[model samples]
Target chain A: MYKKSRARYFFLMPGVVWILAFTFFPLIFSLYLSFTNANMRNFTQATWNLVGFQNYASIGSDLRVGETVVTSLYLTVGSTLLTLTLGTFLAWLFNHDLPGLRIFRSILTMPLFAAPIALGFMGLILFNETSGSINSIIRGLGGTGVRWMTDSWSARTAVLLLDTWQWSPFVFVIILAAMQSIPEELYEAARLDTGSGWAVFRSITFPLIAPALGTVALLRLVETFKILDIPFSMLGGGPGSATQTYSYYVYITGLRNFNMGYASALAYILVIIAIIISTVYFWRVRARFE
Target chain B: MATLKKEAVMQPVRAVQIGRSPLARILLWVAVLMAVIWVLYPFVWAVITSFKTQREALEPTIVPFLQFQPSAENWSAELGLGARETTLALGNSIAISIGATVLATVLGTLTGYALARFRYGIGNRNIVSWVLSQRFLPPVATLIPFFLVLQRLQMIDTVPGLILVNTTFTLPFAILIMRDFFADFPDEIEEAALVDGANPLQIFLRVALPLATPAITAAAIICFAFAWNEYLFASVIAPKDAKPYTFLVASTSTVRGVHFGYLATRMLIAITLPVVLSLFVQRYIVRGLSLGAVKG
Candidate 1:
């Protein structure tokens, strides 16, 4: 019923123009910077050169780069698994009606909105080997205190635990919302026919919410790959690069080491990986949606 | 079990399990209680630690009066008048978050309205998918280039620069959310408005926008929270003067040492605003967090 008018451009042009100028232009510039020999000390035109493929070539030989990739993958996959399991379990638990459940829901999901950097710092305090509360409780129970910060595997576990603590709520809230959206009559009917909760869930509830679960899971997967703030705040990629994510490494290469070319190259590699995963994500989601 | 069955309409999936044995019910409650403790213990511990002295902080003290004496020393040191950097960082965070939220919301809402209500043919589909694709773009990919561009423009270490960068990342979310809200809105009212001799912009301002207040507010809140929680852009682009509280949350240590009490104080400060704001918009948060995929 709405008329076709040119004035729609009035609404669309400003945002489109802003994104093109800010986001698109910077990305194209970054792609160009990835091939050049640009460092912070001589970032100006006089010293920079458009050296083709040198930065990308060195990526093949750089062992630390490979290690960072493995680290990034491990953290991403591990945290995704941890978050999905905990979040889905919580979602299922919260699906029940109990006294004070609403308040519990609020309290449980609070971590999703809290600043990750601060939460990471909180992890440091909570996971401290000798004096932290977790180890203290463990020791009080007659167990040995863990070396969470100093040990390599323990440090990675610390980072994963902190990330899962913060992000499981994202999965929980999304999955719960999806679960709650299902019609009650379906479960009631299933129960009358089967007279079993597990049968009702498997027949009715699980299939309906599987797509939503997939959406949230893939979202978490892509996001966890860009895990920087947590490890940056908690360990600063310590214990000799135990918890250094790809994004953290990129940040170090670009800003800390001032190697803009190599950093841009590293960043592009991540961009490519993100693109592949998200492409698969979109394909799966769209197929399900269709 | 009969009462739970009666309540099944409200919690269908879970209430179906009411026929379980008493022991199973007890075990279920135990699991729920443990989950609650897992979720809340850190924040509770943080509150406890914030009140302790540095010496008390070193110990695994749980209670305030029994195990350790709580003091306001950390609070005073962190928020006192002498804490110039802390206060400035707080101001910078507030300004930058609000600034970016406002800009992104205004532009995104207008654009979203166009996409939702008007037909730009295949361009609409392309624009929607392209905007969604922008969310997948890693921030690190653009980090160096933004640093360079902002540096050349002399906008580095400035509030406006940080705001611009934050707005860029958050604009896609705002657009998608506003578009979802606008698309779901019934067209009959707008059709009546058009028949009443009103233009599209006039209809939007007088009719549609007021109805969309909750959505616009939700979009703005999510944007503000994201910009407030943002650390990467602010770390690189606004290091010196426009340093945010998120950055300073990590920089609380001095030549003295890493003060757990002091760091806890800053962490609480950094998170309190977003946590409180999320409470007010709890219903709309699901849609926002899920990028409008779930109709929460």
Candidate 2:
């Protein structure tokens, strides 16, 4: 039995080592680097200064930092809600016994598979102020074209809209699968009770799939918070930093500005926020299960 | 007696009537159509934009199709099959993504099987949670340290470096999905194989592996898609020799005097592999997503 236990440890060794060296090690090292004033110009032989809590302090007081955080939070929350609502509605629609339903589901999920950077460029072209297809459609509908990438509000909306368009299909697929798994007998019983369509849904479908919905929502929230590629590639966080998400801000600081230490601090804060939000969401989910 | 007969007659009629209201049918069709347009219009735009000349792309038009003379010059230039530099980048992306997926799948399967079969002293719940949390850590936070570590090891700007970095992100997901799949299998089969006097390795290879082929295939497809789509790490770790097609599409627009048509074509080409892969594995992809998101 002891030998068998030892063999199991041996089986686990390679994966554990890989994670330790790659994942955990880098995580700890980055946490330590957040305190020092590291940058590209003074990268080598740079004396590390232990300015405890100063980096964290600066994050709160800095106006630019605060604005970026608010913008990121807004983008994350707005996109999450939009995708969840829209995706749920689509899932419900496709869930019905309609003809060509499989084909519709497949078509709807195509965007999820497209490369993010490619989709970003596509968004840029489609939402471009003067020459975009969207604007052209608006003009055809007797409204003037909107400045999607140039104006602040519109730019933020563009990012949120693009993200929702791309990711809602993910939620739709998952929720649809969960809906299919529900037992038909439950719905039959509700029907026997002379339940209306709305009541049947409320009493049966919604409760049964709440856990799946919660999981999808939590995953989306976490992903949206870290979104960098689409907004960065599309708007470049331009028109006065209007669309600058936290991840993009970190990119600019670390890579563009070469402020590794401050960027590390920012990254840590982002991680903390992600952990807290996910934890809260998961706690609620756990409560539901119990 | 008349009242009871009336109630009985009304119930079924009401149920049938509620099922297919004209308003409900119209709303459902509208919702489905809207979703289809939302997801597909951009891709259609990319296709149309790819065909237009540079000047045509700049001009606004209400027509749903291309207004200018379509050309293939942009497609040829963007694909880089005619040029050395661009072709090299495309090759590098294909090699790295494929390598990373194969490595991740192999290692993930081994680890997954161990967790499934061994039932080690460490609580199974802890192991599962740890695997899931691996994905929760943002790659940006760990970028700098990974960069420094790779640089010190002299692995940056190499295919191996990109593979190593991608594996960190991909392995956890592969393990999580694969473990769920393995758990769904019956342990009785393995016990029966053991009773036949086969060694552990032989049993896994000859019996369990064949049984888990569908799941393993699904996990592989998911990992491949992820590695192919990954951008930030690929951009930072591979500046020159090891840059992928995604980095190519990103950097092309920034280059001065580059044509928009050519850029659009490049974007289209870059998306081709992933789109094809996704279409091929659409069913498995759905399965994997359900397993990952809807915990049993």
Candidate 3:
């Protein structure tokens, strides 16, 4: 028995070692680095000395300090709400009987599979001149063209469009599965109670899928917060850094500008925000799923 | 009251299918069409643009062959790099993703089996939760640490380094899914195997692995897709070497000049493999994602 147990214990060794060396230790080390002045500007010093909150203090003074936070939050909130709402609606649309629904559903998963960086390439073309496909459609219809990529608001919308396009199918598919798993008897019971579509959905469908939607929303919220590749690739955080996200800023600070200390501080800040949001979610919403 | 309510509920369905009016059904079809278009428009556009000549690509015509003559200049230029860098990048993505998936699956299946079967105390729940929540460690927070660590080990610009990093990213999710898979797997078969005098390792290899094929496929696809599409780490760590397709696609920015045709060609190449694989395994995906807090 003891030898068998030891052999079972060996199963976990590789994953544990990989996680520790790559994730856990690095997390701790970065947390430590957040307190120091170990940036490019100060690496010339003989040895790095901990500055103790100075790095945090200078966060407000950083280039990505104020508007970047707002922009990041705006992007996260917008995309999360957009993805959940649109995904739920689509899921609802397909939940009922429809011919060729399987094929449509599978095709919908296409964007979910397309690389976000590749989607960035598509957006580069789609949001190209106002004469691009979208604007071309508008002009062909005798309407004025909008600046899809150059203007700040339009570029922001373009980013949202790009994200929602790629990911909403993910939420849709999950919600639809959750919807299907809902017992047919419940809908039967609710239908006999009232013919009101709104009431039936509100009472029967919504409550049951709430947990799944909650799970999906939590995932999307965190992911939206980590948005980088598309914004970086599509616009390069351009139109004057209007689209730069917190993660983008962290990369710019740490790797681009070589401001390792400041970037570590920024990363910790983002992690704190993540922790707070997740804590709130687990405290409030997670129990409903259970 | 029940009969009345049934009739009332039937109104929407009847109205939706009123063949005489056709309005509601048309609306439904229109909505479905819009959804289909919303998802597929970009790919269609990319495909069309990839086939267009430079003048046509820039001029932006909707009709492909009708408006301008088609050309393969962009595809040939991008794919026909002196050393075939795009092809190399595609191969790199495949190799790295395969490495990450294989490592993640093996370790994950083993750990998942242990978590599912072995009865441990004190640190079990904590360990499981720690492993599960590791998925939430945003790449931003871990990027530099990984880079510095990899650079120190002189593994920064290699496929093995990517596999090492991506396994960390992919392992937590794979373990969670496989744990769920194993937990939900029928224990009676394993018990019968045990009665047949098969040991744990043999039971796992012979009994468990085959039974979890669908789940293992989902896990494999998830890991492969992740490692294939991963960008930031690739950008920072393997800037010039071990450049995966994602990095290569991002590198072709209009920063020089917007070659829509050229960029679209690269985009199609970068996206085709994973997209096609994902389409086949999408059923498992729906299952894997709904259970695993969703895979990206």
Listed per candidate, the RMSD to the true structure in angstroms reads 4.1, 7.1, 5.9
The two-chain DockQ for each candidate, comma-separated, is: 0.56, 0.40, 0.46
Stretches > 4 Å off in candidate 1: A1-3, A42-47, A193-196, A284-290, B1-17, B20-24, B254-256
Best by lDDT: 1
Error of 3 at A193 (Å): 3.5
Best of the candidates, TM-score: 1
Candidate 3, residue B112: the lDDT equals 76
Single-chain TM-score of chain A, each candidate: 0.92, 0.90, 0.90
When sorted by DockQ, best at the front, the candidate numbers are 1, 3, 2
> What C-alpha lDDT, on a 0 to 100 scale, does residue A258 get in candidate 3?
76
Q: For candidate 3, lDDT tens digit of each residue in B1-296?
A: 33453354234221111224477568777899999998888998888899887678878677756887788787778767563777788788888899999999888888877777665653454456666666666789988777777877888789998888888888876887677667655677778888888888888889878888767887888888877888888887787779888888887864447778888888998888788888766656764554354321
Per-prediction count of colliding residue pairs? 0, 0, 0
Q: After superposing the true interface residues, what Cα RMSD does each candidate give?
A: 2.7, 4.7, 4.5
What does fnat come to for each candidate? 0.60, 0.44, 0.54
**What's the CA RMSD of model 1 in angstroms?**
4.1
In terms of lDDT, the poorest run of 10 residues in model 3 chain A is A281-290
